[model samples]
Target: MVFLPSLPAHMQRRAPSRRLGVWLWALALCLCLFGEGAPAWAADGEGDITLSSRYWIDASGVQSVDEVAAQPAGTLVEMDGFRSFSLGSSALWMRLDLPRLDPSQRWFLLLSAAAFTNEVDLYQRGADGGWIRQRAGDHLPVAQWDHPDQTPVFAIDAKVQGPVWLRVMNSPTPTSPRLQLLTENSLQTKRYWTFLMVGGYLGFGLLVLFLGWVHARLYGDRAFVAYCFYVAFMLGFQAAFTGIGGLFFWDQSARWNDMAPAVFMLWLTASGIWFVREVCAVSRHHRGVDRFVIAWSVFGLLYPLLYVNLQTPAAFAVLNLYGLLSVLLSVALCLWTWRLGEAYSGWLVLGFLPVHLGYPFPALRSAGVLPDSWAMQYAVLIGSAIEIPLLLYILHRRAKDFNENRARLRALESTDPLTGLTIPLVLTLRLRDALRRSRRYGHRCGMVLVELANHAEIVDREGREAGDRALVVAASRLSAVVRDVDTVCRVSDTRFAMLIEGPQRPEQLKLLAQHVVARGLERVPTLPVELTLRFRLVSATLPESGDSSEAANDDERLMERLHRALDRLASEPRRVVLHLPVRMPAGA
Candidate 1:
């Protein structure tokens, strides 16, 4: 019976419950450290002032400022807070009643959700009592805005004042107007923080994307490739949704500017599903679920074309529904694959848990169930910041495990199971390479063929188990006697081969032969003391090839000669070592 050593208390495996506690603690610490803080100006209450606002819905979407002002008092409705309107060919007109302020102090009205508005036209009465119109929104370039910024900012005129009229036209998505009236100092503070936060997230995302790309190229893994695509589209979606794309990129193209968020969201969802499918290897286990995932991902990719053309509320609703389904599908796949014994799938689940938890906020916000808030805006961003790097690390670990398993398989195929030496195929391949090098470099290399001459007699007298032990002992002794550069191979049940690569003389070969014979004849502790191993060794220096044809069959010819010499040694009872003379080719 084999006795296994007991592991130390510290080295012993812990219960499954304790396995992930460290990771959980680390995640909690990260969340606490990177938690989002409320805007400094807003928290201080010194930069912004709250103003009462009323709104009128223009169903025709053709109402001028004068026409909106002429409406009956009862026609306008008081807004308690921000309100979201469904996408349609209607315009929302807001009337903001200004408060008396010092003329010297400059103030601006900030629309926190300006990124979602398609067209924002602010009408202010000039000193001359004439209406001055200023335009800002996704439909207009950020550079051309009255106050160029990430979101629309319109100057508040303290002098002219009965009321300021603002018209908002939404694109193919829900529009939620979150207006904040701020002083110049407060606006600058907000801008600074906005830039820092958004810029940091983007920079981190780009770094993760680049790392995923590098791993993709290094491992040639489709999962890493899919991850790169997922990250790229996710960044695009965030940039477009947050108005960063409109402010810096594609700002001049009004058509693309309006459609970017929707298009990127659709593509992001599709690519994320594609990434999950590859990472989980979903198709290999659950074919039906895999098919559904594929179909859903394709639908997400192509639905944007129809959405851009239709631009209907139904199309927008479909997009939101698809997003919700994609989240659920991804989670389900990871869980299913994990259950099916894919360890990486477990990491995928853990890596995306933050995203999964954060998704509901944005999904509800899109569906108009949740009001626009900081959670709705930055929850996904924070989650992605955590998820992206974790996923990349998971992929790295997966690739490493894959390569190690492949190497182990190769080792198993090439090495002997019992003796732990190279098998015949490996020996033959190495011998061929050695012969090729000997021919080209004009070096002398030798092969020593060792046969356990009493292997059958030992089995008959001592038993089959003793014979195996004897072979193991002989293999260990031969390996210990050879140099590190030489290869020891178990060629057959009782025979072994060694390839000694070198520029060597016959004297060295003779010495190596004697050492091999002497070591093999040594007593094995596992065998009986009375029994001794009989070893026959045939050593020969490989001859150089004369032509390409002879070179092709050089290893085979050398192997045949060695076996024949071993047979010849068997006939000579007194001889334990036979040294074959090196034969030169005709031309050489």
Candidate 2:
């Protein structure tokens, strides 16, 4: 007789009808003892065959199939459900009774927690009454396994009968053994969806990584470069953890096949911390936190060296602990920098929120605190898929804002703040370039100096605001009338200058002067309708080759000569425009 564990308190509670409740209790007991203990059938099964309850034994260490089979039946412990084991060098042996199956169909036994087990050897009775052995697991290259997959899968013999034995050797990570029996069709469907989802995730991650690299190169931003490294390591971690690396990337190398997951995980964490530090600009705000983060990153990078050498349960525990601490530290840094008013820090918090919520499932599982579940398998994958693209967008925005601010600063240096026109210094440089071109290329370039003669009169009548508006209007008019190659400058309080590149006749200079005067005299909209702007204009062609003027190559002297001509024109109220000869100096 088999004794079972006690039922729940709710099930044992007294019912209103005592006889009926007694009968129900008897039925439940019979189902637990007899019905659930029956052998599972693989013949004509359309889906998974359930083997939740089976017999298992702790073999303690390495044992041969013959030794395990020779053990007395009393040594086997009956397990009514799945079991989890602490990671160590110990091994476990399970007995599964499979009935005869259809000869035409193929079947497979899947070990769901394949990554946590180093080796799994399956034994079956042959027709000659000898035990036949098969092998699958991470200890050997995936290509050499009985059935190559991300998990341990062994082919089931349709002609075999009676009990089959399975021995599992645990690695340095926690192990929860789940067994599922599948037909070929069912296995194909499972593989289809699994490959599709993992493939989609890997493709998306690569695209985002490429974009991050482009941003790093285009902007020359340390933050973007850090993000690229973070993403690359993230992809590697996912590949290794999901067993894709063993199956496709490095299938032939058994050493790297065993070490890839831990190494990539460590590098992923280190690069993530470094990325956070860069994107948040944490060093500029808090030196203490920044230094702590740097130290943690360095530790994360170097800890793998010790872990690879030791390969102990304690070392695996340390890896999980470090991952948990890194998550907490990253979140705290984001919040701290955000409160200090860092623009990108707020985005960093949002971008990291999904991964933060998903990290605990895998972290606890790795620490041996949680059972294998869907959350432990794919939670981080889903969260990171959302996070990577979001973070890239934040980086893009950061780059764009930085570029705009830089352009604004440069504009403030070279242009007048109110009128949005070049200042005297910028105008002086351009004028020098134009004079050199005129002498070298034998081309004539002209300068027009216009004074707002009624500026003070408007200020006295309508206040200084009106005078400022008039200057703005004049600047706009001057800008609209010139070609794009010309430079317009507000040289003084009541004077403006224009440098026009040319191979022009005198007629064009006169025409431009007339246009400047006409636009200035238009009716004022921002001022009193009766008040109109008055202008005094003087134009001169710069000296070309063969000209005798000493000021031909001197931009300052040429500008001084133009000013004197404008002053002379200002004295004659009857004259609206004057053209100075190229060979004449200011007072000549």
Candidate 3:
């Protein structure tokens, strides 16, 4: 097994900090996992705070105010539900307003929602009377509330200087809904810790990906490395949505802002499916599904970049829907791998369960139904943070076993177990390669056929094992006498063939043959081994008149005839002379 040396370009392009990068990421992830809670909520403005609960009501009492508030009025263009009153829209709407009249002060609105009758919209009104859109700079979608906080927050623009309205509304629907807006300054000291935790998670996630590339180059496996990329994307998404990206790498805000959730969910889903497919051989059963997943993932990945001009909420909705599709696909893949008895399936399902569980939060929050922040989506990232590495370790063990089995098969194919010589297939391939070189370099080559004389007699005298041992001993002696480029193989049960390359005279050949035969006879010192090695020399240069392949076939036939003649010679218990055609023998 000859290894090809690496090209100079590969050596030059090697990463210097690849391993260190991975370690750094691991350290960061560890810190995040054990860290304290998120940052404390603070109002840009100091003012009075109000606490209130709203209800979603329609013709009947089936829908809650929270449910109605959660969905966009446009989407609720035609919804039907039970409400106490005949508020006959598809959903209901309501709000908790901190109403006043001051023009000299800035304010922050922080609230915590308990539950929604269905789901509702929670927003903070600006002094200009417009809702304050939650935009985490360029890295995240434009959100209007504290969806990232899993609580409610409205960061009024620097221009909203004055008394502003804080309102939560539910679209009119058949079902009456209820939700609470609790808390004033949710962004407090806790935010400092949340920033640290989420930032570390993002940093470490990227580091893992960098290390995975290094490990793959060194060890020649890519599945684990691919999983690392998935983890990295999820962490990046968390960081962007949580505003940590804006806080530190503000320059990266634009790139991370829209791309965070879309790319994260796309890459994660695709990588997860690919990992499972490889583990379970899912392609064999449902290849089309895999193709669909890949196509959808690519589309999901491109959606953010392609639709940058669209509103953040709208774009986020589309992205969330894609994520939902990904989760469903992952679930399907898990089932398939499970049914296939895949060892990694259990861990994969466990690792991905949180991601799926967290999938609905984005869409729910985006539609104004779930009064939470984008930060809650990071729960999926946190879950994957713990699951990916453990699952990769499991895959690593399985891969090791698989590679070992393959190596064993390759060994069996190349070597003769009994005599420890090259098998016919291996010998033939080597001979073909050597013949090409010999012809190209104008060198001489020859072959010797050795046979055990009256080998049945040895089996009758001792046992088949003894006969086998005699053959092995003879093979070892021949191998010892041949050049490094030479090959010896058991071409038949009673016969062996040796290949010799490079220039050699007939006298040199005859002497070598006699020496090989003598060594075989000496193997059984007590009794006559009754073995004879026949010499059949064929040069690399054949007659130009004959076709190349046909001449080779004819040469083998000639060898067969010569062996028969030699058997006749040996039958008489003495050697005899055999002359060739007009072609001059080696050394003349």
TM-scores for every predicted model: 0.81, 0.85, 0.49
TM-score of 2: 0.85
TM-score-based ranking: 2, 1, 3
Q: Tell me the spans in candidate 1 whose CA falls farther than 4 Å from its real position.
A: 1-38, 42-51, 70-76, 286-289, 410-420, 429-444, 451-485, 513-536, 541-588
Per-residue error (Å), model 1, residue 82: 4.3
Q: How far is candidate 3 from the true structure (C-alpha RMSD, Å)?
A: 12.8
Candidate scoring better on lDDT of 2 and 3: 2
- Count of backbone clashes for each model? 0, 0, 77
- Of models 2 and 3, which has the larger TM-score? 2
Best by lDDT: 1
RMSD of each: 6.4, 12.1, 12.8
- TM-score, structure 3 vs. true: 0.49
Residue 192, candidate 3: how far off, in angstroms?
A: 7.4
Model 2 scores a C-alpha lDDT of: 0.79
Evaluated against the true structure, the overall lDDT of model 1 is 0.79
